[model samples]
Target: MSSAAPLLLSPKEVNLLKQSPTPISILDATWFMPNVARNATDEFLSKRIPGAQFLDLDDVASPHELGLKHMMPDQKKFSQACERLGVTPSSHVVLYDTHSVFSSPRALFMFRSFGHQNSSVINGGLPRWVHEGLPIERNSPSMIPSSHYEPPHFDARLIRDYQQIVENSKLDPQTNPDAEIVLDARAHGRYLGAVPEPRPELSSGHIPNSFSLPFNLFLQKQGTPDGEYTTFLPEQELRAALDNVVGAQYAEKIISGERPVVTSCGSGMTAGVLWLGLSLLGAKNIGLYDESWTGYAMRPSSKIVKTA
Candidate 1:
C-alpha cells in the first residue's frame, strides 16, 4: 500500500495488494437493516475474503437511549474499536462489504471522521471479488495484537447533529450565506410519505426543504449466475444523478468545494452511498446527518414535510 493509494480500489487492485509486501488491513464492514434476517458477522464467518476481519458497524456505534441504529461512537470508543480491530494510524485499511457498496463507505466515513486518512473501500466489495473468481475462505482471521491507538478528536465538520440540521433548515440565503443543502437518500416513496418506514413506530416523511435523491441512483446491479449484485455507477452517471437532483450549477459547486452538502437517510446507513458518490467527483465540504431522519422525526420540535 503506497501513500498514494486511491480511496476507491478495484477488485484487481485488492488482489495486487494481497501480494504486496506493505502492511495492509482488510475489514469486512457489512451491515444490514434490522428488518433483514441476515446477521453480518454470521455471514462473514460463513464466507469472506481471505484474511479479512469483521468490522461490525453496530459494535462500533454508540448505543442510543431512543434505540437509534448506528450512531457515531465517541472518540475513545472509536479508538478502542480500531485498536481492537488491529488498525494503526499507518495501516492501509481496506474496507469491503458483502452487499457491494453499502456498508463499506460508512466504515470509510467513520475512519475519516476519526482522522484515519489511510483507509479505502474496495470499489465493488466482496461479491465482485468472488464474481471475478478471486479466492475466499471460511477460517477465522489470524489474531493480531492491538495497535493501542490514541485517536484524534472526531471531525465535527464531517457530521451534523439534530440541532445543527434544524438550524440549517431554517436558514434563509439572504441572512445565512453558509447554509448547506440537505439531501435525503431514502427512496422517493419514503421521502414523500407515500410509503411506510421500516421502523413501525417512525413516520414516513423527509426533513423540510431537503431534496429527495434516492441512494440507489448512485448504484448499478450486475447479474451473475448466482444472482444480481450491486456496485457503484460509472463516474458520468453519478455526476448526472447529482445534477438531476441539485441542478448542474450547484452540483459543480459541490464538486469544486464552493458549496456544502449534508446527506441523510433512514438511520444514516445509505447516506454513506451519497457521500461516496460525491467523493468520487472530488467533492468537498460534505457532511453526514448521523442522527438523520430517525432522530429528526422522533423529536416533536422537528418539522417534517410530505409532498405525496
Candidate 2:
C-alpha cells in the first residue's frame, strides 16, 4: 500500500479538505448500541458534517442471522450500496460520527472488510469537527448518479464466525489452524472474568485461547464533555504493547502484511476501538468478531477459559 492509501489523519489533515482539488467524501457514521433508544440515522439527520451523508450500518451489512450485529455484507450487496452512496474504489473516504466514539472506525472496518482500501476514520469525529467550528452542512448532500463499481474478490479467510471460535476452544494443536489470530477487545475485567457483563442474557467470561487487550487501554484518555479524545501513546509505547500481544504464533501472520487481526468485544462496539488502535499502530491482518460475546458466552457448545 502507498503511504497515501490509508490516510489516518489528525485535525491538521482534516482542515485541508476544502483546499484539496481531488474529490474527498466524508461519511457521518454515528450509530448507537442496539439497546439505546436513539437511532443513528435519526440522530444524523438532526445534525452532521456539512455535506456529509449518512452510512446506514444495519442496512449496508450482511443479513444478521449469524447472531452477529452488522457483519460484512456480500461483495455485490456492498458494491451496490456503496454505488448508491456515491462511494467508489478510488475515492478517499473520511468516516466520522456525532460523538467521539468508535462508530467511525466501525465504518472503516466494514468498507475494508469488503475491499475498499482508501477509507479511514477521522480522529475524534464530529465532536472535534464541531469544537473546531468546521462548516457542517446539516441538509442532505447532492447525490451523484450511480456509478459502476467492481467488488473485491471475496476473502472468506478474513472473517471469524462463532462456530470457528467454538471449534478452536475444543480442538488440540492439530485442529488449531495458524492462519488466523483471535483478538479479544473486551475490558480486562471482562476478559479475566472479574466483571459482570453489560448485557444480562449473555453469560460472563471470554473464549478459551483468546488473549485480553482492552480497547480503552489504547485510548490515551476517555474524552470528556468539554474535550474530545486525545490519543496519548508514544510511537514506541504503541509498538511495545502491540508487539507483546501479537508476539505469539500469530506473529508471522501479523508481520507478513496488513489485514490479519480479528477483533471481538462484549458485543461488537468496542471491537471497532481495538481495530482503530491496531490501524494506528500499523498492525496487519485486522478483522472483527461480529458475534463477539453475544454468540460465545451462552453457547453450550463452546468453552470459556479465563487466563491471567
Candidate 3:
C-alpha cells in the first residue's frame, strides 16, 4: 500500500505521535451546516485536542465576490492564512472535526490546493478521540509567530468553476466522450428532489447526467452516542461503493488518472469529502465544483436532473 493509502490515522496513532519528538500541526476544522445552530469556534474554545488550533473555514475562505460561500481563496490569501495559523511549508497537518469526517476533508482540500501536500484528515475526529479517552485541553495554544510560508502558483487542476461545469454538461458524451464525470454528494432524497433543500430559493435536484453519491455513504458509524463519530469505510467497502456509481472498470481508470472526475454538493463542503475519498484511492484527475449546487440550482439557465 502507498504510504498515503492510510489517509486516516487511528486515535491510537495520534496518541502515540503526541509523545514523539517530531512536530505535527493538528487543526480542529470543525464546521456545521448553516441550519445547525452550534458555533464551531465556541465549541473549540471549550475543549479540543492538545496542541490543536482551530481552522475556521468560513473565516479563511474567499471574500465571496461571486456570492458563493467558502470558495477557495487566491494563493497569496491562502499563504497568509497558513502563516497566521503557524503552518509552514514543511508542516505535517492533520485535520479533525467535532462531526467525524464532515468538514475536515474540506480543510484537507484547502491545504492541498494551496500546495501543502503533507496533510491528512484524522479518521473519526474529536468525538472519537474523546470516546477513546485521549487527552483534551480547554486552553487555547498560543499562536506561533507567523512563519514565512510560500505556496507555488495556484493549481487549478483540481478545481472547476461554474462556467466549466456548464460547458461540460452541454457536451455530447458521444462526441466529447472524455468529458468529466460530474458527481453530486448530496443525499438521495435531495438529489432526487424528494426532499426540500436547506437553502431557500434553491431547487432540490442534481446537475444533468450527474451521479448521486451521498458523502455519508463513504462513512461508517463509530458507535458513539447520537452516532457523532463516524469513520471512513474500509478500503474494500469504499471501492465497492465507488464502483456502484462510476463502475468498477471506470473507477479503476479514474483512480489511475486515466479518466476525469468532478465532485460537487450543496455548497461545496461535502463535495470535499468525495474529493478526499478519491484522493485516498490515488485519483489524480479529480476536480471540485466550488460553486456546486448552490450556484447551479439558482441559475435560471442551468440544467437539472431529479431522477435516477
Off by over 4 Å in 1: 1-4, 172-177
- Model 3 local distance difference test score: 0.83
Q: Which ten residues in a row have the lowest lDDT in candidate 2?
A: 1-10
Which of candidates 1 and 3 is the stronger one according to lDDT? Answer: 1
| Alpha-carbon local distance difference test for all models | 0.87, 0.69, 0.83
Model 1 TM-score, all chains together: 0.95
- Model 1, span 149-244: residue lDDT tens: 786678778999888999888874224558788889999999999999998788899887688999999999999998777888889999999999
Stretches of model 2 off by over 4 angstroms after superposition: 1-4, 140-144, 170-181, 222-225, 230-234, 243-261, 306-308
RMSD of candidates 1 onward, in order: 2.0, 3.7, 2.6
Clashes of each: 0, 13, 0
Best by TM-score: 1
Alpha-carbon deviation at 141 in model 3, angstroms? 4.1
Please report the TM-score between candidate 2 and the true structure: 0.83
Worst 10 residues of 3 by lDDT: 1-10
Superposed by TM-score, candidate 2 places the C-alpha of residue 223 at a distance from the truth, in angstroms, of 6.5
Q: Which whole-number lDDT from 0 to 100 does residue 69 have in model 2? A: 60
Per-prediction TM-score:
0.95, 0.83, 0.93
